[model samples]
Target: MSRELEALMLDHGADGVSFDTIVAAGANSAIPHHRPTDAVLATGDFVKIDSARWSRLPLGHDPHVRSRPGRRLATGDL
Candidate 1:
């Protein structure tokens, strides 16, 4: 899933992921910084995605370089 997501981001023009992709399911969902395991997702399990992407623009190119260059983060649960 992480690989797919990374590909998707690259395909969409993101320079790169800002950090490691996190996709936690069930028990792992409670952890904000869980190292993913090979656990298979089951029905009714809580899912969490903490995703971030670096800027497509080069550093110093974006006006808000410090805050915007590599700080995009998005979290979601299901």
Candidate 2:
């Protein structure tokens, strides 16, 4: 899912991800900074995504222009 999100960011014109994405699901969501794994999502589980991307602008052009988007998901919706 992190890979997909990274691809989506790139598709949207981002230069690249600023850092490794964080995708925590189910009990893993309780972890402060859980890294993404191959764990399958299940009903009643909670998911969290924390990611940031660099702008398409050239490096050093604008150090302050980063894109950080975060979201939480509940598998129950699936």
Candidate 3:
């Protein structure tokens, strides 16, 4: 599903993006962006999303560039 979605987004022209395609269950749901383990969901479990989509000009280009004066958030802290 993620591959298909990515292909679709690219085909439609997405400049930049980030994602967390978690498939968690049981206690894992509470772990946030949890990778599946041997644990299983019993009766009630849910998935979480910490995903984002962005558009920016590629380096040395004018398409994905940001035209602002604010400080860019450092990776992992954004």
Candidate 4:
């Protein structure tokens, strides 16, 4: 899921990821910067995906766009 979000950013003209994508689900959702694991999401799990993308602009700090895009993809039966 995070990979797809990165690809979508790249497709939209973003040079690359400014910060690592956060795909926290269920209890992990409480953590804003949780690292993703191999656990499967459940039906009642609350999910949050925070991602930032940047361009190749020369500046003191890279210009970034932070967002939370939504996707409804199921890996298995609920």
lDDT tens digits by residue: candidate 4, 14-64:
888877777878788888678979888888777777787767755776555
Q: In candidate 3, residue 21 scores what lDDT?
A: 40
lDDT of each: 0.65, 0.85, 0.45, 0.72
Tens digit of per-residue lDDT, candidate 1, span 1-78: 767877887687676677777788777787878786888877677677766666545566762211122222223443
* Predictions: Cα RMSD each: 5.6, 2.7, 10.4, 4.9
Query: Which regions of candidate 3 deviate over 4 angstroms?
Result: 1-12, 36-43, 57-78
Error of 3 at 20 (Å): 4.2
What's the distance in Å from true for residue 28, model 2? Answer: 0.5
Candidate with more favorable, higher TM-score: 1 or 2: 2
Those runs of model 1 whose alpha carbons end farther than 4 Å from true positions after fitting are 58-78
Angstrom error of the Cα, residue 40, model 1: value is 0.8
Candidate 3 TM-score, true structure as reference: 0.39
How accurate locally is residue 66 in candidate 4, as Cα lDDT from 0 to 100?
Answer: 43
Task: Tell me each candidate's TM-score.
Answer: 0.70, 0.82, 0.39, 0.68
| Residues 6-72, model 2: lDDT tens digits | 9999898887788988999988988879976778988989989999988745586765478788888
Judging by lDDT, tell me the better candidate of 1 and 4.
Answer: 4
- The CA lDDT at 23 in model 1 is 80
Compare the candidates by lDDT and give the number of the best one.
Answer: 2
Best by TM-score: 2
Query: Candidate 3 on 1-78: residue-level lDDT in tens?
Result: 334544555576665445634445545556755664555445544444333444666578755532222111221221
